[model samples]
Target: MQETHDINIIAWWGALLSTFLALVKLWELWNDRFRIDIGYNFTGAPDIGNEIFVRNLSSKPIILSYWELLYGSGKWPFRKLEEIESPGPDACDIRIDPHSSKTFTFAEENYFDWGLKTLKGRKIYMRLYVAGRRPVVKKLYG
Candidate 1:
């Protein structure tokens, strides 16, 4: 009877430890899922032709400092980064609430500096810089 009791106690401890470990793993997985979704849409407007969307998937608000456009001119093995200059309300001031999204539009005139007629029909990508986190990158066009 004493041996059976000892075995039961050990089994109880084992089950408790397993539960604790599983809880820790669940917490890690929840934290790992903290991220944002960034994408773009071409509006085809004559003046402002592009709209970029940012969605915060985490429970906290996400502040975006700025975003860059990545593109390759030729067969070169490298791409270039062009910082987009938002017209008003500096990009850094943009905040996205948890489970919410925001859109940014750029005027057509901005493309002149990139030597492109328009942002459409070109190989382009976006990289959004977030405070206290790694920059989020996504393919925009091409």
Candidate 2:
């Protein structure tokens, strides 16, 4: 009778652990379901600077707080500017609705002001982030 009780207790513990693990996995899935998706477009290279457009293709709203531009060669990377360095506003907080888009006008003059040389024939990279979200980076070679 004691052996049967011990087996029952062990089985109960095992079932409880399994249930807890399943709950944790479900929570992770729920969090991921709400995360936003960003889509990048290399519009064109007009002479001033590269034109790039960013859009939120996810089904949820995203709050864009900050973004950075990186220009470099080989393996060495350098940061060009942030939203603070640009014109639109000092605070980079912009809310994007689902399937909506926003255009950012980045000029070569801004890069020169940041002490970076002309982006002609150079590889330019971009890294943008939404508030309380991960950073998305993209590279464009012209």
Candidate 3:
């Protein structure tokens, strides 16, 4: 009789453990995973600085793979000003924590030769490629 009771208790514990593990897996599957958002930061005063904000709204961390900014002429037959390419591989690869935001400042110093004065009062378009996701594009005033 004791042996039968011992077997029954072992089986009961085994079933309970399996159920707990299954619930944990289900909970993980239900949450969002690997997603991010990108947008431009407008401070109204252009001379101060221009920046782009990227928010990681996912359960797991992510890396920024590539990005580019194309200045728009804001009119018919729009022309594209100097394109901003991603920095070096080490610099371009940014590790963003889950549910966090990061800001990337524009390289304003290089604009002297490229006519930063003319590029002002125009629209700028930015494209970003995050890890394991489709490319994202956004428009902002330069």
Candidate 4:
């Protein structure tokens, strides 16, 4: 009788462990369901100039708090950084509905004026902050 009781307790623990792991996996999936996609092009069009595209791939709407441009200096092992945040109250006003995208257009001269050319060919990255979630960062390569 004691042997049977021990076997039952072991089985109960095994089942409990499996259930906990499954719940953990479900939590990860839930967290990853909402995603934001970002892309940019530096080649200026005659009419539109350069553009950055922000897309929402989830089923829920998302509010953007702000964004920043990041560039680095120095070699691989040790590097310094500089950041240029989006200016004005408009930066915090962006919102994207589910399965939609928004394009931000700016002139080439504006890029130069923004001081992005100081590093000359250095790679740039964009960091976006969304309300109630971690920030997303991506390389700005065309």
Cα TM-score of candidate 2: 0.49
Top-scoring candidate (lDDT)? 4
lDDT of 2 by residue, 55-104 (tens): 77667788878766565455436534323233344765888887777777
Model 3 spans with C-alpha error above 4 angstroms? 1-34, 43-47, 72-82, 88-90, 107-122
Q: Please give, for residues 35-131, the per-residue lDDT of candidate 1 as tens digits.
A: 8877766655638566778788888888888777666333345655454553445544578889999887666676423325644445566777788
Clash totals in order: 0, 0, 0, 0
Candidate 2 vs candidate 4: the lDDT winner is 4
Better of 1 and 2 by TM-score: 1
What tens digits encode model 4's per-residue C-alpha lDDT throughout 29-51? Answer: 88759888888776535345667
Candidates in order have lDDT scores of: 0.70, 0.61, 0.69, 0.73
**RMSD, each candidate, Å?**
4.5, 6.5, 7.8, 5.2
Among these predictions, the greatest TM-score belongs to: 1
State which candidate, 1 or 3, has the greater TM-score. 1
- Show model 1 residue runs off by greater than 4 Å: 2-6, 9-17, 20-28, 73-77, 82-91, 108-122
For residue 142, model 3's alpha carbon misses the true position, in angstroms, by 8.5
Model 2 gets an lDDT of 0.61
| TM-score-based ranking | 1, 4, 3, 2
Alpha-carbon deviation at 35 in model 1, angstroms = 1.1
List pairs with backbone clashes in candidate 1: none
